[model samples]
Target: MLSGLQRDSFEYSIHNANPVNGLVRDKSRDGWPASIAAVGLALAAYPIGVERGLMTRDDAVKRTLTTLRFFATAPHGPEPDATGYKGFYYHFLDMHPGRRAWRCELSSVDTALLLAGMLAAAAWLRYDTADENEIRKLADALYRRTDWQWMQHGEATVSHGWTPEKGFLLYRWCGYDEALILYLLGLGSPTYPLPAESYRAWASTYRWKKIYGIEFLYAGPLFIHQLSHLWVDFRGIHDEFMRQHDLDYFENSRRATFVQQQYAIRNPREFEHYDELCWGITASDRPGPRTLLVDGIQRAFHDYIARGVPFVRRLQTKKEPTWRGGRGLTSR
Candidate 1:
C-alpha cells in the first residue's frame, strides 16, 4: 500500500512538470503557478524514480538538467517580475514564463526545501558521463550561489523571507516548526554559512509543555514535527536543545504524533468523524473562515489554515489561539 502511494506521488511530480522548463506545478488547479519547492522535490524524487524502476536514468537526467539549467540561467534582479533575487526563488513561479508568480516573497523555507531536493539529486546522479557531471556542477553552483547571510538581513535569526517591495519579512524562523530545513541549510552552507549562534537563537524560542501526561516540545501543527524529517535524519543526532532535553528530533516527532493521536481520541471539539483511526491535522484547504456551531459550541473555523492543538501556555480563555497567524482548531 505504502509503495503504491509513493509511486503515485512520484508520478504526480513527473506528469505535472512542464516539459520544456522542467518546473513542476504547485498543485492541480486552474492556472496554478509552478512551485520552486515542488521543482526541488521533483528533482530529489527523480533519483527514487530511477531506483524503483519507475523512470529511466536517462529520463531522470534530462529532467534534472532542464530544471537546473533553467534555474541557473533565470534572471535575477530587484524587478517585480525577475526570476529571483539574491539566489533565492519566490514561493511560486509562472509555469511558462518561469518568473515570479503572485508577486510572492522570496520564500526561505521553500527555497530550503528546493535546495534539499537539489542536493539529493546531485548526490545521486554520480556518473562520469557529461550530463551527470553537468548535473553535479549545476547543483554545486546553485547551492553555493545562495547567500544565506544575505537572507539573514543583519539579524541573528533568519528572516522568514523577503519581498522586493517591502524588503525583509517581519517573521523570523524561531523553531519547533517547518523552518528546520531552512536553518539547517543556512548553517551548513559553505559559501554563506550562518553563525552557530543563529541556531542557538532559534532553538531558544522553542516551548516545552506536557499535556495528557505526554511531554514534548510544543508545536501545534503535526507537519511542524514532520516536514524537517523529510530531508533530515534526526536519529542519533542531537542539537543543543535536544541534548539538553535528553532526546533527539526523531523522538520529538514521535511524541508530537502521539499528542495528535491523543487529541483525536478525546475528540474534545466533536469534529465530525474524528477518532484514533481517523486523525491527521495539517495545514489544509477547507470551506472558508467563519464561526460554526459544532456540538453546540461556537467554534471559529477557517479555510486553508494550519490547524493544530491549542497552544499549551498561550491559550487563555479562548478555545483556539493564533499567534502571529500561526494555526487553529482540529480537523475531521
Candidate 2:
C-alpha cells in the first residue's frame, strides 16, 4: 500500500494536470503560478513510493530531481521559461506577475519545506553524487533564522507581514513542521544540541485563536507530525513544552480542509469558490477537474476539515480576541 503522502501526491498530480501549458497548474484562482505546495508534495511522494515497494528510492529520487529541474526552469506566469513567480514572495497569475513588488524575503518556513522534500528525494534517489552537505547547508540556513512567532497554531502572517494572527491550518502541513523541528533541535546549526529553554521560549510565546481554518487542517499536520517526532526523542521536555503552551490537537481543523477537498471533487468549477474554500485549497486542482476521494476515510476527513473552516475564519477575521487565544492558557 502506498503511504498517504504518496497517494495524495498522485492525486494532486492528477488534479494539477493541465493541457493549455505542459505544466502542472498552481492551485489558485487565475492560478497560473506554480508554488512550493506542488514541489513539496512531489518531494514527499518519493519516499512514500519506496515504502510501498512501488519504486526504488534511487528511481524515485531521480524522477523527483528531474521534476525539480523542470520547476526551476519552467516559465512561471507570463514569463516564458523564466525564473517565474516565487508565490508568497513573488507570484504571477495567468502569465502576469502580481502588481505588488517582491518584498517578502525568503521565508524560512517555505525554504525549509522545499529542502525537506528535496532531502527526502535525495535520500530515496541514492544519488551517489548527491551533495548531501549542500542540502544540509541550505537546511541549516533556513532553520537558524526561522520566526517561531509566525507559527502559532491558530494564526499566521497578515498580508502586510506584521502582527502574526491566526492562519489557515492547512499551510502548516506544507513545511512548518520540519522547520520547527529543526529549530527546536538546533540541528540547523553545526552544533547538534542547544539549551532546551530556547524551544520552550517558542512554545510559550506562540499565540492564536481557535477556529478551524483550511491551513490549520490540511497543512497543520506537518507541524504536528514533526513535533510528535521531537516528543518521541525528548518526551520529558516536550511534555513540559506542551503544558506551557496549553496546546492540543484541534482535530476539527484537519476535517475542515478535507471537506473542502471533497467539495472540490464534487464541484470542480467556481460554484462556491470563496465560501467553500480558501486561497490555498482552491488553487490546487488541475485540468478537467472532478472530485473523488481516493482514500476510504476521505469522507470522514472531509467532514472534519470542512467543519473547522468557519470556526477558524471567524477567529482570524474577528477583531476581538476569541476563547482560543493565548499560550499556556485559553482565552475563555
Candidate 3:
C-alpha cells in the first residue's frame, strides 16, 4: 500500500505539473492555485522516481531544471502579482505564469519546504552535466536570497508569514510544529543565516509532556513530529533542547508515535473505531461546519483541522514554557 501510494503521489506531480513551468497544483480540484510546499514535495519526489525506476534520470533532471529555472528567473518584487518578494515565494501561485495566487502570504515555511526540495534534488542529481550544475547554483541562490533575519520582524522568533496587504503576520513560528524545517533552513543558510540564538529562542518554546508516561517534546500533530525528519536527518542530532532532555528529536518522535497509539487504545474521547489497530490522526479534510449530537453530546466539527491525541492531565508532570504563537495550541 505504501509503495502504491508513493507511486500514485509521484504520478500526481507528473500529471499536475504545468508544462510551461514546473509548478504543481496544490490540489486536484479545479481552479486551485499551486502550493509552493506541494511543489517542494514534487521536487523532492523526482529523484525517488528515478531510484524506483518510475522515471528516467533524464526525465527527472528535466523536470527539476524547469522548476529551478522558473523560480530563479521569475519576477520577485512587491507587486501584487509577482512570483515572490525578498526571495520568499508566496504560499500559492498561478500554475502557468507562476505569479502569486489567492492573496496568500509570502510563506516562510512553504518557501523553506521548496528550498529543501531544491537542495535535495541538487544533492541527488550530482552528475557533472550542465543542467545538474545549474540546479545546484540556482538552489543555492534561492536559499541564500531568503532574508531569514528580516522575517524575524524585529523579534527573536520568525514570523508565521508576510502579506503584501498587511506586512508581516501577527503570529510567529514558536514552539514545535512543521516549521522545524523552516527554522533549520534559515540557520543553515550561508548568506542569510538566522542567528544561533534564534534556535535557542525557538527551542525554549518547547513543552515537555509525559504523555502515556512517556516524556517527550509535546506537539499535538503527528506530522509535526515527522515532517522535519522527512527531509532532514535527525537520527543522531541533539540540539540544545534535546541535550537538556537527553533525548534527540528522532527518539522523541518515536515516543510520540507510540503515545498516539496508546492514546487510541485508551480511547478517552470514546471515538468509535479508535483502538490499538486503528489510530493515528494528523491534519486532514473533514466534511463539517455542522453540529451533531453524538452519544447525547452536542459536538461541532470544522471543514479541516489538524488532529492529535488530546493532551491530558495524565501527560503532565511539570510545566514547560511553550513559544508557539499564531496558530491555535492544537487544531490549526
Candidate 4:
C-alpha cells in the first residue's frame, strides 16, 4: 500500500513536468507556474523510478539532462524577467517560455532544493558515459556558480530572497525551518562559501522545548524537519548544536514526529477531525476559509495553508522572533 502511494506521488510530479524545459508545476490541479522546488523534487524522483524498474536509466538521464541544461542555459541577470540571478533560479518559472514566472523572488532555499536534486542526479548517474559525465559537470557548475556570499546581504546569515524591484527581502533564515539545506549548501560551496558563523547564526535561533513529553527542536511545520533529511543523512552526524545536545538531527526528527503525533492525540485546539489518525497538519489543503462552529466552539480554518502546532507560538509571545515574517503558524 505504501509503495503504491509512493509511486503515485512520485509519478504525479514526474509526469507533470514540462518535457521541453523540465520544470515541474507547483501542483497538478491548477494552471500554476512551474515551482523550482517541485522541479528539484522531480529530479530526485527520476532516479527512484529507474531503481524500481519503472523507467529506463537512459530515460532518467534524459530527464535530468533536460533540467540541468535548462538551468545552465537559462538567461540569468538582474532583470525582472531573467530566469535567475546569481545562479539561483526564481521561485517559479513559466511552463511555456521557461522564463521567470509570477514575478517571484530569486529564492535561496528553493535554489538549494534544486541543487539538492541536481546533486542527487550527479551521484546516481555515476557512469563514464557522455550523458553521465555531463550531468556531473552541470551539477558542479550549478553549485559553484551560485554566489552564496553575495546572498548574505552583508550579514552573517543569508537573506531569504531578492526581488528585482525590492532588492533583498527583509528576511533572514535565522530560526530553525527548512533553510538547513540552504546554509549547508552555502557553507560547503567552494567558490562562494559563506562563513562558518553563518551556520551558527542559523542555529542560534533554534527553540528547544518539551511537548507532550518529547523534547525536540521546534519548527512548527513538519516539512521543515523532513525536507533536509530528503538529501542529507543526518544520522550520527553532529554539528555544534547537535554536539551540545548529544543528539543528531535524525533522532531530533524522530522525536519531532512523535511530538506531532502526540499533539494530534491531545488535540489541544479541539479542531474537527484532529484525532490520532487524522493528525497530519503540515502544508496541505483545508476545507475552506470560513469560521465554523465545531462542538459549539468557533474554529477558524484556512484554505491551502501551512498549518503547524503552537510550539513556536509560545516562544514568539515571550520574545520577538528573529525572522521578520514570523514563523509559519496557521491560526486555528
Candidate 5:
C-alpha cells in the first residue's frame, strides 16, 4: 500500500512537469505555479523511477538533462519576471514562460532543496557518457553560482528570503526547521561558503526538551525532521551540537517521531481524528479555509499552511539571550 502511494505521488510530479522548462507544478489543481521544491523532489525521483522500472533509463536521463539545461541557461536578473536572481530561483515560477510567478520571494531553503535534488541526480547518474558528464557539470555550476554570503544579511544565520521591493525578510532561520540543509549546503559550498560560525549560531538556537518523556531537538513540524534526512544521512554523524548531546541527528529524529506519536496519544488539544495511526501534522493541503462545527465542536482548519505543534515551551525569564530575539526555555 505504501509503495503504491509513493509511486502514485512520484508519477504525478513526473507527468505534470512542464516539458519546455522541466519545472514541476506546486499542486495538481488549476492555476498552480511551479514549485522549485517540487522540481527538486522530481529530480530526485527520476533515479528511483528508473530503479523501479517505472521509467526507462533513457527517458530519465532526457528529463534530467532538460531540467539542468533550463536552469543553466534561464534568464537570471533582478527583474520581477526573470527566472531567478543571484542563483536563487523564485519560490513559485510561471509554468509557460518559466518566469518568477506571483512576485514571490527568492527562497533560500527552496533553492537548497532544489540543489539537493540536483546533487542527488549527479551522484546517482555517474557515468562516462557525455550527457551524464554534463549533468554533473551543470549541477556543480548551479550550486557554485549561488551567493550564500549575500543572503546572510550581516547575521550569523541566513535570512529566509529576499524580495525586490522589500529587500530581505526580517525572519531568519533561527530555531529548528527544515533549514538545516540550507546551512549545511551554504557551509560546504566551495565558491561561496559561509563562515563556520553561522552553523554554530544556528545550533545555539536549538531548544532541547523532554516531551512525554521523549527528549530531542524541538521542532514542531514532522517535515523539519524528514526533509533534511531525505538528502543527507545523519546516522553516526556528530556535529558540535550532536556531540554535546551525545546523540546524532538520526536519533534525534527518531525521538521526535516517537514524541509526535505520544503527543497524539495524549491528545492534549482533544482534536478529532488524531491518534497513533493518523497523527502527521506538517505543511499540507486541506479541504477548506472555513470553520465548521462537527458534533457540537468548533474546529478551525486551513487551506495550505505550515501547521505545527508546540513542542518547545517559551517562558518569560531573564536569562542569557539566544539569537533571533528568542527567549531561553527548555520545556513547556
Candidate 6:
C-alpha cells in the first residue's frame, strides 16, 4: 500500500507529461522514478507473497531479476505510447538527465529511491542483474549529492511527493527502518544526523495544526511504504505526539485528501472512490481555497509537457496581471 506513494508520484509525473497537457517539457524524462518504483514494488511485494507461501521464492526471484534487467537497458522509444511506457522497463527510459542541475531535485531523489529499490531487491531476493553495479553507483551518487538547498520547510503542503524536509521526517518517525536507511546509507544522505532535530522542528514549528494534518498524503507514505520503511521508529515517536494532539493517522490523511480536492488533484485509492471522483474543490464539506497553488503547478507542468521544451524567456513587453476570486473582509 505504501508502495502506492511512489506510484502516485510517478502517475502525477506521467499525467503531467501526457499530451492532454504537456507541462513538464523536456523534463518528461523524469517519469523514470515511477517506473522504477513500480518494478521495485512488484519485486518487493511479491516476496512477501512468497514468504506467505502464496508463490514460490523461485518465482519471485525469477520475476525480480527479469524486472531489474529490463529496467537497466530499455529504450526511450516513442512518446505517448502507453504500452512501452506502461510496461515494466520502458517506464524509466527518460529518468536521468546527463548532469545534475538544480541543487535539490527529483534526479537525486529518484536515483536514491531507485537504487534503494535495487538494493532491497538484491538483499531480499538476492538477485543480481547487470545493472546491480550501476544501481550501486547511482546509490553512491545519491548519498554524495546532498545539497541542503533542496531541503525546504513546510513544502508538503503542495500536491507533489516528499521534499527533503519531509524526507527527513520519514527517516525519523516512520516504522520503515530499511527504507530510511536506503534514503540515508544508499544516498549517503547526511539526513540522519539531523533527523532528530529536523523532526522536532517539524512537530513544533507550526502554530497551525491543520497544516500539519495537510502533509500526511505525501509524508506518510514516503517512508511507510515497502520501498522506504526505515522511518518507523521515528514515526512511532512522532505518532505519540500527534496522538496526544489528536492528529492521528486518519485525521492527517483526511486533511491531506481535502487539500488534494481543493487543488483538483486525484486521491490515492484508499481515500474512497466516491469521494475522489465526485469530490471537487467546490464541494461543501471540502469548500475553501483548498490549495490554489496546486492549480498554478498544474498549469506550469501542463505547459512543459505540451511544449517541446521550456525556455525562460524575457518578455518583450511587461504585462500586468489582475486578481480574481471572492474578496476577503479587511480587518480594522
CA lDDT of each prediction against the hidden true structure: 0.83, 0.38, 0.83, 0.84, 0.84, 0.35
lDDT of 4 at 151: 95
Alpha-carbon runs more than 4 Å astray in model 4: 286-289, 293-297, 303-305, 311-332
Question: TM-scores of the models, in the given order?
Answer: 0.90, 0.43, 0.89, 0.91, 0.91, 0.35
Worst 10 residues of 4 by lDDT: 315-324
Backbone clashes, each candidate: 0, 43, 2, 0, 0, 32
Model 5, stretches more than 4 Å misplaced?
287-289, 303-306, 310-332
Per-residue lDDT for 1-332 in model 3, tens only?
Answer: 98998889789999988967899998898888899998999989899999999999999999999999999999999888899988899999988789988888999998988999999999998999999999999988888899999999888899988988999999888888888999889998888789988888888888777655678888887888987886877888998789989988899999989978987887765778999998887765665667788889876665555365552222322332122342223311
**Residue ranges of candidate 1 with Cα displaced over 4 Å:** 291-299, 310-332
Of 3 and 4, which scores higher on lDDT?
4
Candidate 1 vs candidate 6: the TM-score winner is 1
Clashes counted in candidate 5 amount to: 0
| Clashing pairs for predicted structure model 3, backbone only | 174-324, 175-324
1-332 in candidate 5: lDDT tens per residue?
A: 98898789879877789878789999898888999999999999899999987888888888899999999998898887888889898999988788888889999999999999999998999989999999999999999999999999898899999999899999898878899999999999999898999988988888887656677888777889999998999999998878989999999999888877876876665677889997876775776576788788776666655356532233323431112223322343
C-alpha RMSD by candidate, in order:
3.7, 11.6, 4.0, 4.0, 4.2, 14.0
Candidate 6 Cα outliers beyond 4 Å, as residue runs: 1-34, 49-55, 65-106, 115-195, 198-236, 239-251, 254-332
Tell me how candidate 4 scores on lDDT.
0.84
Q: Write the per-residue lDDT of candidate 6 for residues 23-99, one digit (tens) a residue.
A: 12232344322344444444445546566555576655555544444444333222332212111122232333311
Leading candidate by TM-score: 5
Report how far residue 104 has shifted in candidate 6, in Å: 13
